[model samples]
Target: MHETRTIADLALEVRSKNAGPFWVTMELFMRDAVGYTIVADPAYLNASTVARLYGIDADTVQIFRLPALHVVKISFPRPVSQGSLRDRDIHAGQHHVPLALFPLPSP
Candidate 1:
């Protein structure tokens, strides 16, 4: 039987942080090129999937693929302004959890 793998399992690091007062940035530093390709594939982690995961519009998600570095960077507008009364994560530090825990598509 094949073992299931998640983003966190294939990545060297998965992190999220505030890009600014209105934006959040998340990065996936894959362990190698293979992991990078898997994470960078639109079939696996496209704007649509990111939208569903973060409750944001697909058009608002910007994905940057750095195959040379085995990194994937994603940025999106925050639902609420940083430090606003409605905001929960001021730093957006824990926002990567959902993506990190997301299961990779079966090969």
Candidate 2:
């Protein structure tokens, strides 16, 4: 069986912030090149995968891999407007906690 490691173990940082009133962005910073390659692959960080992870529509998910920076940036439409009465995250920074728990195949 393949060994697995949570993103918290593989990434140096996992965070989220508001892109705008309508969007929230999540970022993953890898500690090394191996971790970067694992998460940066299209098979892992694409729209479908992120959509499944965030429980959002696939069409709303977008991801960018910054190899030079060892970062994976993901963005999607926000369910509620930023700072709206129903919004739980005013800065959208708390939204990435679940992603930190995502299980990845360990290297």
Candidate 3:
């Protein structure tokens, strides 16, 4: 039986924070090059996936692949401005939960 692995399982660290007042950034620090390749694959974690997960426009998502660092970085527009009345997470720290919990595609 194949055990389903999630992003959290492959990444050494998964974190999210406010890029600014209007955007949030998340980083996936993979444990190795193989893990990085998996997370960095567009088919696995692209703008479309991000949009669906966050309920935001796909066009607003930006994914950065850093092979050298074995990291996948993503940024997206904040639904509400930081510190605004409607903002629940001022630092955007909790925003990575969904992505972290997302299961990797089966091979």
Candidate 4:
């Protein structure tokens, strides 16, 4: 299901309301979007937000940049190293891409 609040609104609301850390709204946008996009910014999201939203450690969510519409290089900054994120970038149009986070590999 879709979220009621827009991404901009949600971000602003989060800072303003300090709405507990668990309530994060995952956002989807056109791939062509430029400049500090949510997808890029969230690469360095704080730990508290991850716990509040996905019930997972922010550190566990490996973020990476992808080339094709189907894959990416996942980098784990801790014990393990990197992996590939597959099929998740399958967006409808060619103009936009997706930034996805998945679990880090076990050491």
Ten consecutive residues with minimal summed lDDT in candidate 3?
A: 36-45
| Better model by TM-score: candidate 3 vs candidate 4 | 3
lDDT of 3 by residue, 47-79 (tens): 999999999999999999999999999999999
lDDT at 84, model 2: 89
Superior by lDDT: candidate 3 or candidate 4: 3
lDDT tens per residue, model 4, 6-96: 3333222111111122222233322333322433444443344444444456665444443232122222222111122432222211211
- Best-to-worst TM-score order: 3, 1, 2, 4
lDDT of 1 at 75: 98
Where in model 2 is the C-alpha error above 4 Å?
1-4
Off by over 4 Å in 3: 1-3
What tens digits encode model 1's per-residue C-alpha lDDT throughout 6-103?
99999999999999999999999999999998899988899999999999999999999999999999999999999999999999999999999999
Instruction: Name model 1 segments beyond 4 Å from true.
Output: 1-3
How many clashes does each candidate structure show, in the order listed?
0, 0, 0, 3
RMSD of 3: 1.1
Model 1 — which ten-residue stretch has the worst lDDT?
1-10
Off by over 4 Å in 4: 1-29, 43-48, 67-107
Best by TM-score: 3
